[model samples]
Target: MKLLLDENLSWRMVNKLGVVFPEVVHVTSLNISQPASDISIWDFAKKNGYTIVSKDDDFEKIVLLRKAPPKLLFLKTYNLNTEKLVNLIIANNIKIKEFINSDENDIFEIFGE
Candidate 1:
């Protein structure tokens, strides 16, 4: 599954997460406007088949309101360094895969401890 990393996340994560999520990309790398709006990113992901990866709760609210074409992976944590954040995602790789593949669920949350 393709993943669109939100601007809140570091662009460097695109390379770090590439080991497992080969199709991952950060918003800055795209042609879209700098500091893209959540709606714009949502629309872009829907059009391009990218599942959004973000720490923002706005996406969850959007998904609840609009339903999903572009799935969401919500990172439910705060104050984590990029390395730890990357590790959190990497550690939950299998669950993420299952989440992407499942049709019953559109939002998968990964909590950091």
Candidate 2:
């Protein structure tokens, strides 16, 4: 599945994890205006077949309000360094993929180690 990293996430993470998530892209790289809003990102993801990877609770509310086409991966990892976050994702890659491929769920959260 394609991943659309939200504005809260660094675009560098895309380059760092490109091998694992080849289809990933970041909001900063999008053609849309810089500092795009959550709603605009959501709309973009929905239109582009991306599963959003974000830490925003606003997205959680959005998912609750309107289910998926753009799935949500909520990162609850608090205050982690970039390396730790990357490692955490690498470790949980399988579970993340499974969650994405699941038919019944639209949201998946990744908590820090």
Residue-level lDDT for 29 in candidate 1: 84
Can you list the residue pairs that collide in candidate 2? none
- TM-score per prediction, in order, is 0.97, 0.95
Instruction: Give the per-residue lDDT of model 2 (tens digit) for 69-102.
Output: 7899998998887777777777888988998899
> How do the residues 7-59 of candidate 1 rate in per-residue lDDT, one tens digit apiece?
88999998999999999999988888888999999999999999999999999
- Give the TM-score (vs. native) of candidate 2: 0.95
Off by over 4 Å in 1: none
Which 10-residue window of candidate 2 scores lowest in summed lDDT? 81-90
Candidate maximizing lDDT: 1
TM-score of 1: 0.97
Q: How many residue pairs of model 1 clash at the backbone?
A: 0
Please count the clashing residue pairs in each candidate, in the order shown. Answer: 0, 0
